[model samples]
Target: MGYSEEKLIEEKVFKDPVHRYVHVRDRVIWDLIGTKEFQRLRRIKQLGTTYLTFHGAEHSRFNHSLGVYEITRRIVDNAFASRPEWNEGERLLSLCAALLHDLGHGPFSHSFEKVFDLDHEDFTREIILGDTEVNQVLSRVAQDFPKKVAEVIEKTYENKLVISLISSQIDADRMDYLQRDAYFTGVSYGHFDMERILRVMRPREDQVVIKQSGMHAVEDYIMSRYQMYWQVYFHPVTRSAEVILTKILHRAKHLHEQNYTFKHKPHHFYSIFEDRMTLEDYLKLDEAVFLYYFQIWEEEEDEILSDLCRRFNNRNLFKYVEFDPAKEYKKLAKLSMLFEQAGLDPEYYLVVDSSSDLPYDFYRPGEEEERLPIHLLKKNGEIRELSRESDIVDAISGKRRTDHKLYFPSDFLEKEKARPEIEQIAQILELNLDNGTI
Candidate 1:
């Protein structure tokens, strides 16, 4: 058998809580799973700092990657099999793309990316084309096979159908993460009829379309996404942990720039701090390495660094109140000045975090971050955008919802409540420090 056609002696099955069982048989996929770079996902989290709010959300990207591959397998092997629209030759390519889509996520994924100005998508492409175990496994199939997979992940592949299987708004990546994250977080909001959505999926010349019969299921999925964003993804407690984590990274980077000596030197972060991080330096980082530093940094000499690390390590997160930047810029300025007068570092202590989401959208080419909207195929073979066909989808189709919160160490302010500055800060925040109304 050719490299692409090879199959394992027996199927390898991983027991999964969300999908029941994720089976692997293709030789290329089996080998890719064994590669060290893929195994590294077991140590990285799927939802960074979310576990601080939802303790059960400790699952890793390994679990999610396998789930995505399994969903794609069901779609190709069951739904699209022998269909003239879906080329059988693209089966393995779709599977490979689905499996490796999130291959480059780092520890504390989003927060780390923000502080370092790093993009996981770029790192993912590098891992596939660079001199690495994943590259070697993919090269066995074809010299350009690694590049093909990278392009699919990059959404630049010529085959739009293959790209839709992973990159589309309703693709395998979102399907798997929504269900898997809901299961691990023990929340009811992420629950949707994924089985029905998978069954109704049809391959189009340029994108995936759903049968109109499955429009209700698709609506449920969209609403689930909306609820999850507010209930879990943007939970204030989770955002609090994220704020502290971001400050920790910023403090470390600043200290590195200041030539501050450390008892527990950040050897793993040196390359990143200097803005010269290589692939090897990146692959060496995981939650374990970061948590180790956080535990030890609690003892560092710098008060800000030590306090922040202590809070993260000990779950003493910051408290937050609703803040609207557009309507209350003056209020925010007053709070910042009062915080400074009370000896609190406004840069780290006073933080305004905003989260926004557009539940669904129709395709608009000129808009920023253009998304190919979900299309539904009617019984008469007419195709229409989902929002136009379904009232529930239309209600929130193009509307963008944004929320902002101002985070601070309320305990710090409470200790000095007798001071005039602290009193003014508490009044502005609508926080009664005397009675602990925060």
Candidate 2:
């Protein structure tokens, strides 16, 4: 007997601030969410340490997973309903792909990746295809259904419509996160007319395109992305938290390598430290487990590990100021020496965080890693690349922006005795203590 496409006896809705209501009708998605793995998302923060900067961003991946599913449902309904271009057979596949996209993301995903040399995307694929509850549910649909969903995530699905629904230049994932993050962070910068964008979206051969009249709407999205990148995504204070978290992981791993015995074993981190994490172990981890370890590690005999853990837990994020990377290396070295003299381990205390991103891009012929350029369908049925038709997108397209900030603990230096030396270090870093300039 084949797996039946059954709807829940009673429809379920998750009250989401961004999407308002995330509706679940299908039994499979409901079952998957109820599984232990999906519930773990509640413990994993959606924004990592951004919660330290934007307190309301304490929402979890469970919140975001539902948002993604809601966005995917809306997009599929709006764009693919009664349309010949979209295969109705792929609707469930698209929703499943969206819901499970971030399932493999670890606690503090990017920082964990940097310290452990791991890729969340690879882990995401593994989770969907491995012996997970997700894999079992998907396999029940068809023996190869799990592979199809995984392929959609990997952008190699034979069904381009399925692929586009989850991962186009302006797809459901970006659409949801922009509005959801903006709402949670109370930042209006990420807002755009989502209904307008969805209304104009049209699926076509192997991709999705917008109607020509929606050009301005697309421009709004591009600009919103630009502002969000600077104002939220790359905020220095958020990066400061990241710096502290990274150093914490580094110190712990270093101690582990030196055969040091932790007063409390960081068992959840064992797979990460050894670089052989199975999907099962990975699924067991989330931010709460990490936070639990952090709370316990605050009392460890290791000064560096304990301090870094305390700093992360208490939101004592490092202070940051803009730096001229080309000319600042020498001065930075002297500051490191000063930190060492103060009995602070410069290796764990001083950090330079540099981040760069291109919020929007235009397609270039023969480019190796070109973005799937957004297209607008004309009345005459011709398709035009977004930047070619919209000046706003053209202005920012392919323009890469970079930001660098040097981070340190200003509070530690604010004490009366440390004030003079702290001022000296601040001056060397070209920081404006009075104005909070960075």
Candidate 3:
């Protein structure tokens, strides 16, 4: 038998703060949401370490996942369900792909991925195609349905139109996360006309495009993304917290490699340290699982691991100063030496982090893995890339901006002001100790 097209006798609704009501009609989606693997998302924070900086960012990935699914549902069911340019057959595929896109994200996904050299997308594919309950449900739809959903997430699907709906510049994932993150962070940067943008979205032969009339809304979205990237996503304090997180994981991994006994071993992280994270082991980790270890590790005999865990758990994050790696290598080296002299290990105490993004870009042919540019569909049945037509988009299109910051435990140096090296290091780093200014 083919995949079931069964619809629920009545829809289920999740009262979301961002989307208001996330409606679910298809039984497959409902069952997928109820699966153990999908339920695991509720335990992972949407913004990871951002909550330490912005107390309001305590929302979970499950919340953002539902919001993404709801937005994609609106686009497919409302805007294109009756349109000939869109394939009605791919509706479930798009919805499922959107819902499960972030399923593989571990606790503190970015730092975890970096320290362990892992990809959440790879885990996402594994979960959907493996022996998990999610795979079982998808296989019932037809043995290949899960693969279709996975491909959409992977951006390797033959249907470019479907891939763009979830992965493009102005796709449902960004549309949901921007508004949802803004609402949770209590910031104004991520707010834009998602509703109007959705209303203007049209599926083309190759991809989804917005009507030219909605160009202003699209411009606002691009600008909103730019603002949020700097203000919220790239906040230095948040990065400071992330630095500590990355260091904590690295320290734990190093200690494990040396066979140094951890007073409280990270049983959940064993597979990760060995660079062989099975799907079962991956599913066992979440923020709570990490936090439990952090709390316990705070009492460990190792000063570095204990201090970092206490900092992360107690919100005693490192302080950061503006840094340019190309020009500030000497400054970083000098600070490292000072930290070592001050009895702080420079390997764990001193760190540099960078955040960068291109606000928008039009497609460049033959560019491997470049973004698919935003398009504006004209009334005359013509198509134009956004930067070619919009002044606002053109202004920043193809421009990549990067910001770097150096993170260090200020308290470590401040505790002993009698040491002249601390002052010299502070002077070189150009920090305002009075106000913790960079």
- In terms of lDDT, the best-performing candidate is 1
| TM-score of every candidate relative to the true structure | 0.97, 0.92, 0.95
lDDT of 1 by residue, 320-434 (tens): 9888788888898888899899988899999988884212233222235467888899999999888888888778656677788999999888888899999999888889898
lDDT of each: 0.90, 0.81, 0.86
> Which tens-of-lDDT digit does each residue in 15-44 have in candidate 3?
999988999989999999999999999999
Off by over 4 Å in 2: 1-4, 357-369, 416-424, 431-438
lDDT of 2 by residue, 7-74 (tens): 88899998878877899988888988987777888888878888888888887888888888888888
Candidate 1 overall Cα lDDT vs. reference? 0.90
Ranking by TM-score: 1, 3, 2
Error of 1 at 127 (Å): 0.7
Lowest lDDT 10-residue stretch of candidate 2: 357-366
Candidate with the greatest TM-score versus the true structure = 1
**Candidate 1 Cα misplacement greater than 4 A, ranges:** 356-369
What TM-score would candidate 1 get against the native? Answer: 0.97
